[model samples]
Target: MNQPLPQRNEPFRPGETALLLVDMQRIWLEPGADPSHPERGPDHYFYRHTAAETIPNQERLLKAARANGVEVLHTIIQSLTEDGRDRSLDHKLTPIHIPPSQPEGLPVTSLAPAGDEIMLPKTSSGVFNSTNIDYVLKNLGIRYLIVVGIMTDQCVDMAVRDAADRGYLVTCVSDACASATQERHDTALNAFGGYCWVADTDTVIARIEALGKSA
Candidate 1:
């Protein structure tokens, strides 16, 4: 089995790293019609739910990342239109049911880029796949990526692999991520361990806080 890259015990370089939050929308959180299986109706079969089950912990990480002045970027996997022409094959296989136009204050809403937070609209698995994320990161001179959010095995795994391939230092906050099943979550984390640093929420937060104290 591939092991995760070795992580230094110290905090990441705050000035050159950012926290990427992926797919935390309400549609994924609440019980609703499964876009992947619309024929099953809203109440049929087991539903794939978000880690919002662990929202408090996720929120803690977000708060810590923000307080440390790390750039915060939010990503939502929604198509530009209903037809989803912009979506990749992976998206077509497991579709998300977002409306043609995402209203303001909607769950998974895009962040305003003016606040040093870039909102990346991705129609695919990895954030780097069809977005300007690479350019933005390069422009900001960022070399490390601290990733958090839902579906540990899917989107998160994709991001970690792609980031590593691009030669960026990557880390996954284990406790801050979730999946439909513990097995799925473990599988992704183990796979990611081969390509990125994996740390629990507390460890990651402590490192970030220490950075604040030293600075």
Candidate 2:
């Protein structure tokens, strides 16, 4: 059996951990010309504010993770094909309009991974459910994950639960994540506090910088 994860402080063994960027793709981050889900509406005020707070933090966080030798991984939602068959009810019916359907080249709004950084294109909220991310993480000896992304209430929450269950120490960077609205964001963060330790981007960044300096 695999070994258990470390307590918060005891983890972070150089190359043995990673920073995961979840669903920061343009379709999710920026409002499209045509709203995908008419019900959800073209990204509202809450989304704009959330993005304002999250995007910068993630950009800084990713920078620190890279300089410190922590593996940087990104996840983007993309359909395997244009056929609506592979998508869920919401995705099938709601058409995406921004850069429409295809995943755009990153470095979007100060957040983009280096060519060496791995990009896991997924179709589900739980990154593990749709990709070989778990296998890749395990191969890299990554027993802990620092997660930062868009929509803290949905994709981030689902990924955290899955990661913890799979025996990886999960750290949810609160400020580096956002929801469509503050209410939803706070709800998910506070509700799942027990499942994972939620942290701030500044604190995480300092820790990474300090550790990198010492090493």
- Clash tally, candidates in order: 4, 0
Per-residue error at 43 for model 1, in Å?
11
Global local distance difference test of model 1: 0.71
> Model 1 — which ten-residue stretch has the worst lDDT?
104-113
Top lDDT model: 2
* Tens-digit lDDT track of model 2 for 163-202: 9899888899998888877888899999877778788988
User: Looking at model 2, which ten-residue stretch has the lowest summed lDDT?
Assistant: 96-105
- How high a TM-score does candidate 2 get? 0.85
The lDDT per prediction is: 0.71, 0.76
Query: What is the alpha-carbon RMSD of candidate 1 to the true structure?
Result: 5.0
Q: Encode model 1's per-residue lDDT on 35-152: one tens digit a residue.
A: 4434543343223334333455667777787788677787876777767776787777765435447542134322223355677777877889878898888888877788887789
Candidate 2, residue 160: lDDT: 91
Question: Which candidate leads in TM-score?
Answer: 2
Quote each prediction's TM-score: 0.80, 0.85
